[model samples]
Target: MWVLVFFDLPTETRTERKVAARFRKNLLDDGFAMFQFSIYMRFCASRENASVHIRRTKNNLPKKGKVCVMQITDKQFGMMELFHGQKEVEPEQPSQQLELF
Candidate 1:
């Protein structure tokens, strides 16, 4: 599963800037990679794992901003189409193989 996080946070005031920075840091600390500006993505081994990360993201939401988070299966994410200007770009690659204990 893929946990997609998209946020638009206010950066007008110093405090807002700090908040936005902290949010981005938190996402990185949780293993999310920057898919684009203000957008982060993480891969989970299963739906349960994705849910846990989603909950963590929700818990650390900033005070003032728009945040949208959703989960999609790996197959769904794989089907995404990408383009860079007129040239077509390849979609993002999935994470490393899952580990089994």
Candidate 2:
């Protein structure tokens, strides 16, 4: 499972910029990696685990911007095509996650 967070936060003022930076930091601290400037993604062992991160992301959302959270299966994510200029490139692999019972 993958939990993808997309956000567009206001950064017009110093305070707003600080708030946006803090939000990104929180996402990173919670194990999400930057997929784009405004997109962060994390791999989870299960749907339940993905839900937990989604909740955490919701809890940290800024008061003045748009935020969207979505989940995708590994197969769906794999079908995505990435490109740099005119050349195609492979997506970076997600790190292996180990679960202990």
Candidate 3:
């Protein structure tokens, strides 16, 4: 599963900019990578793990902005089409994680 976060936060004021930066930092700290400037995504091992990250994203939402959270299965994510300028490109594959007991 994948947990994706989309946000549009107010950044006209200094404080608002700070808040926006903090939000991005929080997402990065929580294992999300920047899919775009306003979109962050993280791959989870299971739906339950995705739910945990989704809850964390909800907990740190900005005070005055729009935020959207979405979850998609690995197959769905793999079906995405990516392009660079006029040329098509392949989407990145998720990294394999090691589990140790």
Candidate 4:
């Protein structure tokens, strides 16, 4: 399971800038890595784990601007295509899990 967070917060004012920085730091402290300038991603042990992190993200959302959260399976995330100079490249898929039951 993966949790992706996308946010765009107002940063024109000094206080707004501080709020944005604090939000980013919170995401980092929560184990999310920066995928883009304002996008962060994290791998969760399970769907429920992802949900917990998602809730945390919601709680820290900035008072202004837009925010979006998305949950995706490893398989679905693998299908994401990246384009560079007109060439389409699929993202590397995560290794198969070895579950012991």
| lDDT for position 92 in model 4 | 45
Q: Summarize candidate 1's per-residue lDDT along 7-65 as a digit string, tens digits.
A: 99999999999999999999999989998988899989889989888999999999899
Candidate 1 has a TM-score of 0.90
lDDT to native, each model: 0.91, 0.92, 0.92, 0.86
Clashing pairs in 1: none
State TM-scores per candidate: 0.90, 0.93, 0.94, 0.81
Clashing pairs in 4: none
lDDT tens digits by residue: candidate 3, 8-99: 99999999999999999999999999999999999999988888889989899989999999999889999999998999988777878776
**Residue range 13-100, candidate 2, lDDT tens digits:** 9999999999999999999999999999998879999989999998998899999999999888888899989999987677987668
Stretches of candidate 3 exceeding 4 Å from the true structure: 99-101
Q: How close is candidate 4 to the true structure, as a TM-score?
A: 0.81
Q: Which stretches of candidate 1 lie over 4 Å from their true place?
A: 97-101
Pairs of residues clashing in candidate 3: none
Model 2: lDDT equals: 0.92
Q: What is the TM-score (0 to 1) of candidate 3?
A: 0.94
Pitting candidate 1 against candidate 3, the one with the higher TM-score is 3
Off by over 4 Å in 4: 83-101
- Summarize candidate 4's per-residue lDDT along 1-101 as a digit string, tens digits: 88899998999999999999999999999988887899989877799878999999999988898999999998778778778679997764444445587
